[model samples]
Target: MILKCVAIDDEPLALELLSKFISQTAFLKLEGRFSNAIEALSFLNQNEVQLIFMDIQMPDLSGMELARILDGKKNNDKTRIIFCTAYNQFAIEGYKVEALDYLLKPYSYEDFLAAATKAYQYFDRIHNTPVAKSAEPTATQEFIFLKVEYQLVKVMLKDITHVEAYKDYVKVHLKSKANPLLSLTSMKNMEELLPSEKFMRVHRSFIVALDHIDSVAKNVIQIGDHQIAVGENYKEQFLEFLSKWMS
Candidate 1:
């Protein structure tokens, strides 16, 4: 799926470079380019672009302020934003507004591709996958059908040991299978499908099935043959689960 995107930057050279990067990417299509945020916002009001490459600082309207406005809009289309700025101070703030990714100024084509690839994977799942509708987990729902290539493979929730993020896809580890089931979806998608009561995200790249945990030591969880490290961001929640288990 091609993502229709727009770029907004006050710098003529930066805007041209960003547009060039967008054009170099196979899955991204540059729909518009604006030197200021006001014109970009006005164009966005009428256009349905899937992704935006924006500068955080601009005259009249800042990218952050325009993002806030876009968030409040009643339109059905949700456009993901990637903020490009010289200042690194806005990194945390950019994520707070739910920007897809932040690019530091003078970024390489490789860095640009990484951020754009993330957007492509997100849109690919939204437009091409059925997991959004059929994979919603419930208390009694014990199984889910995962799209693998052209066929839907039925996987029992009880058999799941953990879900591992494999680049753009996720590996659904199961007790019954010799190898994990590879699905063309994000870790976020898998987390949404698995019952939260039974599964917990121990790390950004690993979600462990509470029932299948073999051991825990030094912030690492052992499930079967795999040892998954607990990320610092997730440590508090994982420890809370442990405290409950011990109690």
Candidate 2:
């Protein structure tokens, strides 16, 4: 699915850079660009955009204030945000507004691509789009290719102990490796890609291998060293699954 996006930055150079980057991305369509938040706010009020690449600090109105305004709007719930700023101090604030990613200024193309990919995955999940068709495994398929760093690493589904959500990315913990495979994707995407019988989303931030779980205690599923809490929303289904093991 193509995401309609806009860039809001006070700096001409920054706006130009963002416009260029958005143009290069395959799934992103540049709807508009603004040098200040005021014009962007007016544009957003009239038009519908799925994503916004905005600078936090702007003259007259800051991006944070713009986000607050957008958050209050009923029609802007689907508008995802990616904050592009020079200061890393605004990272926490960006999270408060449910931003898809935070691009630290002077970032490289790889960093930008990663953030863009995360946004793509976010939209793909919400819209139920099959953008990553090649990554999807068939019923008989045992492994999947994950884009890690620039390489498509082949990983066996059975080897994954659990999936951990880290901001815009997901860390796939493998039993065969000491380090988990960090990919620029969301937990929702991972949960949808995995087989329902073998893997289950036990928490908003976690998906665990049901067969790999060592025990269940205090609403937590233990898989090796990892302790994943069962979210309140998913607890009923999880408890029903546990009923099969009761004596």
Alpha carbon lDDT of each predicted model? 0.83, 0.83
Angstrom error at residue 174, model 2: 16
lDDT of 2 by residue, 1-247 (tens): 6789999998999889999888877677999999999999999988999999999999899999999889888966589899999999999999898888899998766566667766765665556645468678423335555667765466788999999998877899999999999987668667766768788888889998888999999899988988789999999989988997563
Model 1, residue 75: distance off in Å is: 4.6
Error of 2 at 159 (Å): 14
Worst 10 residues of 2 by lDDT: 137-146
Tens digit per residue, CA lDDT, model 1, 1-247: 5789999999999999999988867677999999999999889888899999999989999999988888787752458999999999999889878898999998877567657766765665556555455766322455665666644566787999999999977899999888998878778767766668889998889999999999899999998889999999999999999999889
* Model 1 per-residue lDDT at 155: 74
Error of 1 at 214 (Å): 19
TM-score against native, each model: 0.56, 0.56
RMSD of each: 8.1, 9.0
